[model samples]
Target chain A: MAEAPTNPVALAAESTVATRMSAPPSFDVADFPVPTGREEEWRFTPLERLRGLHDGSAAATAGGSVKAEVTTPEGSGVTVETVSRDDARVGKAGTPVDRVAAQAFSAVEKATVITVPAEAVLTEPVRVSVHGEGGVTFGHTVFRIGAFAEVVLVLDHTGDTVRAANVDFVVGDGAKVTVVSVQDWADTAVHCSQHNALVGRDATFKSVVVTFGGDVVRIHPRVTYAGPGGEAELYGLYFTDGGQHQEHRLLVDHSAPNCRSNVAYKGALQGADAHAVWIGDVVIQAAATGTDTYELNRNLVLTDGARVDSVPNLEIETGEIAGAGHASATGRFEDEQLFYLMARGIPEEEARRLVVRGFFAELIQQIGVPDVEERLIAKLTAELERSIA
Target chain B: MATLEIRDLHVSVEAEGGPTEILRGVDLTVKQGETHAIMGPNGSGKSTLAYSLAGHPKYTVTGGTVTLDGEDVLEMSVDERARAGVFLAMQYPVEVPGVSVSNFLRTSATAVRGEAPKLRTWVKEVKEAMARLEMDPAFAERNVNEGFSGGEKKRHEILQLELLKPKIAILDETDSGLDIDALRIVSEGVNRVRANGESGTLLITHYTRILRYINPDHVHVFAGGRIVESGGPELADKLEAEGYEAYTKGGGVS
Candidate 1:
């Protein structure tokens, strides 16, 4: 097995029109050219809905419209600070992989960094709430978990804003971290964010990304290992309504030996022009022996006019890995499932609700937060009520 | 006691070439507390009768009249029919991937019984019914019929029959895939429901093996979409010795 060089010039030379794998990764926004919807990564996304986030036209303005609130457990040695863009740890976890991400890197005035002290076991989750007041915003947030520290970090986004931001997680050796990022934006908002995680030796990183509201929301989650024995789990759930576009793209780069990764995302869509897309990519470098990974994406179309695109790709340079596989499926509600429920005395409408709820139950349970799970279920029920009417 | 009466029932299903009739003039009567077995070979329209009674959309009633306790059963929707005391245990139960058996049972009970069941008593009753069928308690949390073995599916159908307590229960081919042990267990569940004397049992099957455990009060031989012979339990014994040969000769019951 030969490892393809990851250099920018070499990758550009190997670039082909059929795949996004050749796109070079760079920290500078100019390294990658602006997309024209011809690239595989940008073909499914509507460029106009991005609100100038991709072309570097959306500039930062004064009078910050988005407010932030942070809460941490007492005596946990946790610190939250706004650091300059040139700080030493600004891009330590990940570099900008695309133009928009790189533009976000160069545009944010200040980046927020939340750190947990080594060996600190927090009994409560650290919560970050960001509310927008109708304006264009660019931001960055990083979570640095120390060795052997176990904590849950929640990022809640709301309100209306044309927002593009970068979120990074730097998990220390032997650390356990769970990050839940929720996008419950206003209907008029447009959101695009890139989540990058650098997992350390023997560390565990679990992420749950939930998107429900927003006119156009696109999230890219990427993971790379700092050392061998690292593990990553990514779970996502989204509900797309009439005229909404929601997309999630994920990449797990297994450059370290003995690392494992699992990705599962489920979505439901209804009404005209409702669209959902999920792309899962797992790349195992030649040296990454004993790497095990699997990814799955499933979508349930609840109405006639909705559409979904699910693609799962696995690029393995080494055959010595333990196991690697991927699966993708997009379909409408199973008529037999509905009929089964209705036969048991459940009315037609309620039967549809139960079937949809059950389709998402597995991923929702992975959130591991009771109140969050309950709230999401309530929201799902309300969304389903509209279909009945 | 409730009575289910079907008079000259004509049912058709949409096929590639216009509508194809499946049950042409099926007539029968099932009274509460009685176990009537409808025996027929494959393609004899046995399951169609069960599904039609439950008002499956695929089966259209071109001409028929079905009444349960003097109420028009044919005029109601599928769920309405269930609430109106009609239950059909399909031969191939559908697999519901995410709804747990316990949750499905509770929801169905809530809809049929018109209110939520008391938590304490409902849990106890479910546990008791599972125990009677020799089912593991852990099975209650599993998805309904998803990945269930044939025997397990039959047991689950009977489990519902014992729990829902519908006025009329149509068990379509409940003995098709059951092993001897599962057959005994499922038969016992059916007997318990019949012992209540408030529900009528329409046990549909293709074999007489299950007749050893669940003795039908009356047996009807069905062929070519209609009942050709009806008699006491002795009819089942005769069919066991002699197959549906006497009924299949003329294609419409010789």
Candidate 2:
């Protein structure tokens, strides 16, 4: 399905700048012209480091696969199945908007679909652990949650592979969904993926994306409202190390009236040539009256030769909106904050840990899962100890 | 008894042109249980003296000798100086977002005491200390000075002063911005420490108002980036009556 192209006449009549992204959504790999690193969306990404995920030269037969294991609570009544490409619910949530996603859709042999019935409140989170075994992989996943249902999903990615995938959430009206996706891939891995959420009327969807490893990892998360009163919250945390490139791009499309969306992403970069990029784009269509939106991005540069680029773009087509705002800041470790803590008898190393931990503590608590929170904290501690030492 | 002795302390800070000297030569010795008020006009380098003693990286000790109980203080790092019984309550306390007051205090105490205090006793200690300062217990969970008002920042500094219990405590214009009620409340906390006779106090101020609440045994008149006049408590009385015009009249920058 090709996304409807923007009408220049309508744009002129509405007197609003064109905000529809240049590339239209499609499930065919041939729709997107090959990017030469000059395209706005491809500028910050190192196309070469993608190892052919962009150009389709990398053989999909790299002799390894991403094995997935799903654990459902007893009597949870959640059904997880591997279905063919013709599954009716597969593309209902989202379609490919970029070449990598289209390639993933065209290359995958099977798709995984998870479903929950209406009004079911889950006491335990559905855990999906995907392990890559050193290969080229393309995949697709869809989660369909029924109306008024409450669900928590955890997607844990590990191991080494060159992979491109698309994951979508089809939330029903008045349903609430929380998704925590952790990308702790190996250092040799190259990962590029897209995540989409179609929030239903009066529904709430929250996503936490944590990235720590991989030579080059780029994730694009896009959210669109299915009806009025829908809400979407996107939060992310990433740590970039020496010779690593991590980029996170987000889009929140307020296509319905009376919807809300928020975005906050934080990253810490260290070592020579470490680069982290954050791009947040929000569009309030003419019909999205009474919308409320805000976005924030913050980065901490821990060492010399590190770089960060943060950009936030907000476009409104209607004058009747509740509110909109954005803020972005990238700073070195504050000397005064460190000095203040050291003067209070905290050693230099401990002081550094305190400030870095404090920086992430706010977002970690928002995950709402104690087990994941503790594990992430432990992972952060190990990372800090290594960096400081 | 602990003794903090400073002799011929000269400090300079980096300016646009070159190194500009802030403290020409400061000499003082504060012994345990002694409260010495160093009153001066603005830009007299009183805060410089405080920061230099606490080993602020911004200041260079061009020529100086700072010792505590005959041990070289100039040789220690900031945290070492802190653990070695030296504390500076900054005039403008730095904000540490996401670090709770309780966690900060407990961490500082652990570093100073060389071990973590028993959790039960530590909570009790913090509760009692906050009560005495008329502080709400909820403040403990609040971030360190993130959005605290003027009086609240000052009170937090004093809270640390009492909780950390360093041998030599330097208050850098801590009374600069406080209401009368807050002034009395803060002074009472200082007086409590002074009465205990466990730590020496170096009170830096631009006004004589706080002197009424916590009496000083000695007062030094600071001007021209150094002390020009030294006297007993009578010196504070004189400065209150006449002001520092007597000291800054002759080519000395105020």
Candidate 3:
């Protein structure tokens, strides 16, 4: 099926499916259609790369395949269930009706089901690790937290091998879940991951995604509020150096009353021809009264050749909310603050590091888990050191 | 011995149409362990002298030089001047957000001393100093000068003075915006420093209140950007009774 053109009408329809990103795993194109470049929402994103998956690239073959592991990690409150790969991948033979339809259904058909027990409070996080030593490998992982259960999940994407992977997530009602996903892949790896989360009424969900290094990376995190009084917090930080292209697309929906959502993402891009894009959108329906939503996206362009494109969008059907605001800025370091620090006897480079470290310190401290916080700081500092050279 | 010699110093700031000179040929010398008071009117440029001495990026010094212990203070960078033992207890200290008072003080002390102090000893000393100033020790954990009341910020400035122990300190209007109680605590902190007998102080103020407690040996009246009259501690008492109008009416460019 051909994709719709980018326009207001098609954008409206795409917005609907984009809003339902957190729905249960189902590979039915009729349910969730692939948004075309013609839609205003998909304008800057290169859909052509997504189409690359169909041309025998993302196909799953039984021979010479690689397997990924998902382990429950310490300090993360959830657990993972082991599922067979053959049961998860359902596609066979040649082309299907719709490309999106074939991809979604095929993955959902063979998804490994990890369900959180009701009222179960998990203290250790559920860890997911993916390792591929050969050609590109594609897989889908799904998580469902049972009602009234509280759990913390940590997704660790790792591989000594080079390949591509896709992962998805879903969160349940009256349940509070926190997910911290750290992507520290091999320098030569190509990573393409997608995360979908559905939040139920009075349920709170928080996700933090950090990417250290990747060749060509793309992450799509789609969250939808299914029940009233739901809340979601999303944070992402990515560092791309030496011709790396990292892009993260986020969608947050306020579908019912008393819903709240917040997003804050920061990135530092360095070296020649390195590019990073952060696309964020928030939707407030007419019924989402007393709804509060806010988003902030900041990019630090450290070099002349490096570039960052950021977009913060608000789609409000009616303005009957407590508060709604969006802010975005892409720029270099601040001079006055630097001068103040320099005046205090700190060198220029040390001052820059302090300001940048302080800029992200609040989020680092808020990570709740000490080990994860330390790991993140070490990785981020290593990237900073690379940028200095 | 370390000495801060202000030799025929001339300073000015931008005014209506041209430069309005604040200090005109003002000459003063502060040797180690000596305290001098610069008493003047609100616009008499006492703060200008302190700011100029501290190497504030603003406050142009058109003539003369400031030398500390035989080294040219004017040529030194802000941090360099600081590390060289020149501390300014700013009248309006900046509120640096996202930086805790302890962190900032430790960084400043480390830079000034060129090495980290013993953590246990430093903490104990900081606690003792805070107690002397009647400051809550919790203030040290808070961000530097952020959300502090007028008296609290001033006392914090004194806390830095107690910790850094610079060779020469220029107190610019530290007495202003302070209450009688805060003034007493600040004066006591100054006395403790003087007790060391190894540091010099240049106290700049418009009132004789702090002088009554600090007990400076020399008091000079700054008029039209120059010292029109100089005397002992009695000069501060004289100014308190008579006011600066007499000096303003009689003085010309000197």
Which prediction has the highest DockQ against the true structure? 2
Winner of 1 and 2 under DockQ: 2
Please write out the lDDT profile of model 3 over residues B75-187, one tens digit for every residue. 98777888898888888777565567788777777877889889999899888999999999889988767799989988988888888888998888999999999999999
Q: Fraction of native Cα contacts kept in each candidate?
A: 0.70, 0.78, 0.20
Q: Ten consecutive residues with minimal summed lDDT in candidate 1 chain A?
A: A1-10
Q: What is the TM-score of chain B alone in each candidate?
A: 0.98, 0.98, 0.96
Candidate rank order under lDDT? 2, 1, 3
* lDDT values for all models: 0.87, 0.88, 0.72
The candidates, ranked best first by TM-score, are: 2, 1, 3
- In candidate 1, which residue ranges exceed 4 Å CA deviation? A1-23, A60-64, A386-389, B250-254
Candidate with the larger DockQ of 1 and 3 = 1
The digit string of per-residue lDDT tens for model 2 on B193-245 reads 99889999999999999999989988999888898998898999999999999
Runs of candidate 3 with Cα error greater than 4 angstroms are A1-67, A73-113, A130-139, A157-166, A185-192, A214-218, A238-247, A267-278, A298-310, A327-352, A384-389, B6-28, B38-65, B72-77, B206-209, B219-254
lDDT of 2 by residue, A1-389 (tens): 11212321133232222323335667878787776888777788889998888787764554468888998777888999999977777767666767888878888878999888888899999999888898898888888888999999999889999988889888889999999989999998988888988888999999999999899999988888888899999999998998899999898888889999989998988899999989998888898899999999999998999999898888888999999999999999899999999999999999999999889889888888898899899988888988887
> What does candidate 3's lDDT look like per residue over A247-345, in tens digits?
887777676789899899988777897888888888887777988999988887777898788988788877889899999989776665555554455
Q: Report the C-alpha lDDT of model 1 over A1-389, residue by residue, as the tens digit.
A: 01122331122233231247324666667777778888788888888888777776675352337988999998889999999988766767777777778877878878999999888898888999989888788889988899889999989999989888899888888899888889999988888888988888899999999998899999999888888899999999899988999999898888889999999999999889999989887888787899999999999998899989888878777899999999899988888788777788999998988899999998888878777789889877877886655
Cα lDDT of model 1 by residue, B1-254, tens digit: 79999999999998898998888898999999998999987788899999999988888999989999999999998999999989998899998878899999999999999999999999999999999999999999999998999999988988888889999999999998888999999999999999999999999999999999998999999899888899999999999999998888767421
- Recovery fraction of native interface contacts for candidate 1: 0.70
